[model samples]
Target: MFDTLPQHLELIVLTFLLAGLVKGVVGLGLPTVAVGLLGLVMPPMQAAAILVVPSTVTNVWQLAAGPRFLGLLKRLWGMLVGIVVGTLLVGWLLAGRNWPAATPLLGVALILYALLGLSNKRFRVAPRHERWLSPLIGVITGGVTAVTGVFVIPAVPFLQALGLEKDDLVQALGLSFTVSTLALAITLSQHGSLLQADVLGLSLLALLPALAGMYLGTWLRSRISPLAFRRCFFGGLLLLGADLAIRGL
Candidate 1:
């Protein structure tokens, strides 16, 4: 079954598997890992294109796992809107081109995210201020996502600061990421980056490995120490980010 796949297909499959495993264990990083690794060999836009389906599907599952979906949506509506608008604007600006220029920005983002994770920083937002802050962060996150295809920075940290319970935090992340993925899909489609027959087909094929890795990761989470594993994960991200930065520069 695997023999007929093109050589690049193997690399794509491996990338998804690794990314999916990270998401399964840590509840995030599919796009971060996928885009970071894939960017080494392909244009960042193409990497982003490949991430659309898998990111959407996995995040949908995450979003559906909790009961607070509606509540979170209500609170995050502004951010969601900002994300769509921001991504659309930036995507329009950079569409239909190799856009290798964006790789360094992506590299910086990955490194920053990893550093934050390693530092174990905590940010908190007061309930009274959430209304204004959510949209602000959303716009920033969306713009960054448009440029880099990774959606973790201000968004994840902002969500983390909300003081939500663990389950709610996870669900909220799912909601945010789901919106990001949808917005990215739309932007890519408009820019002509995601319309290729082969891109779409390969994206669908990559889902199998992504799902399998997720399952395996979930199982491993129970057996492994997540904190230790997270440290390693972040460390790896740091290296990947540095490599991308060096290559881009």
Candidate 2:
């Protein structure tokens, strides 16, 4: 059945499907799963390039689903600015370099994020301190995304700390991810990593499988326990992350 497609393209489709499924179940992890798994067969930059359209499309869906868009934006603009500036500056400096050196960092980040998720240790950021701390977290998250192509760690934790309601939290995450995806795309374009015709075409094509998987996952989410699924997802990420770290080393 798969014989007609190029091997790499087939891999890309499968990876996006899995990534989208994870996202649908957990409301996150699309980029992390896609980039982490795709890195096995392609450079991280290429993986990141392919993620642009799918990530943006899904996140936009996520971002649009909530009622708190303006409020979240008002509160998060500083962090958003920091994300853009930080990603652009750092990504420009590191562009065109061999990507393997960065893979271990990506691996370590995934492991840490998984560990944090598993620990269930909640960190709170009081409302009074948002003015300063928000931008700081944004800078750190942006820097990490620029290098690793994964944007979860501090960003996810930071958003969680804000004490948003369940729906609001998910929406905030979607907004943050959307911004990150856009910024990452610009950074990659500046670095000339996003201009390849095949990469662009594949990224567009991958969206179909990604959305299909998301729909399937959403259906399954209604039937399954989210907590149980999340545990499995984190466990899987931990193992994959460790493997990537080992490979990078």
Candidate 3:
């Protein structure tokens, strides 16, 4: 699906729009949607690279305008630690195997997570568990992010369960992406996928479309009901997962 040029660009644009809408409404999801959908068209590694710049740019904007410094400082310490461990582990896992298989696993995880969200039974992580679970979830987030650029699934659910407010979620998501991006970029560089020229060029090129999507999505978010948007997001995930599984088979 991602192999062809014209269609690939179209899909990229469409996914960007959808991702931004989800993020604008719920306060997070560009990577969750982009990775799940684009993974169908490209190898997971390429999918991760394609999303890295856009994710960074949007998160940077959010970090700059959305919250207080102490607030971010308070939540990120644990999440960052986990992301570091998970990113390193994922890098090791991808050392020599067929890296493409990561796409299918990503699809499976997204499908499962979308369903989890639909259940309406939030899994709360207590303050007592925060010390351990935060890092554990962070590692999971970082690892999944390194492999497929889809860390929001595990991390978001845990944070939501913790009952963080919208502003807090945005802050945490921004920081999480920031840390995960740095770690993944380092690993990708080690593997020779994140060259300086490639990063600079694509970063410049992908910025505008991502911002456009963010603004459009944010606008649309107000018109749609939260329940309706959740349904659409989950439905989209199911279709994307089915496509990935069937095509991979």
What is the clash tally of candidate 3?
2
Which residue pairs in candidate 3 have backbone atoms (N, alpha carbon, C) closer than 3 angstroms, thus clashing? 2-41, 82-139
What is the per-residue lDDT of model 2 for residues 43-121, given as tens digits with 9 covering 90 to 100?
6766888889999999999999998999999989988888888788788888756555788888899999999988889
Q: Which stretches of candidate 1 lie over 4 Å from their true place?
A: 1-6
What TM-score, computed on C-alpha atoms, does each candidate reach?
A: 0.95, 0.95, 0.88
Residue 107 of model 1, lDDT score: 87
RMSD of each: 2.8, 2.9, 2.6
Q: Write the residue-wise lDDT of candidate 3 on 79-107 in tens digits.
A: 78888888878787786244656767777
**Top candidate, metric lDDT:** 1
| Candidate 1, pairs of clashing residues | none
In candidate 3, what residue range of length 10 has the lowest lDDT sum? 193-202
Per-residue lDDT for 113-186 in model 1, tens only? 99999999898899999999888899999989888889997899999999999999999999999999999899
Q: Which run of 10 residues does model 1 get worst, by summed lDDT?
A: 1-10
Distance (Å) between predicted and true CA of 164, model 1? 0.6
The worst-scoring run of ten residues by lDDT in candidate 2 lies at: 1-10
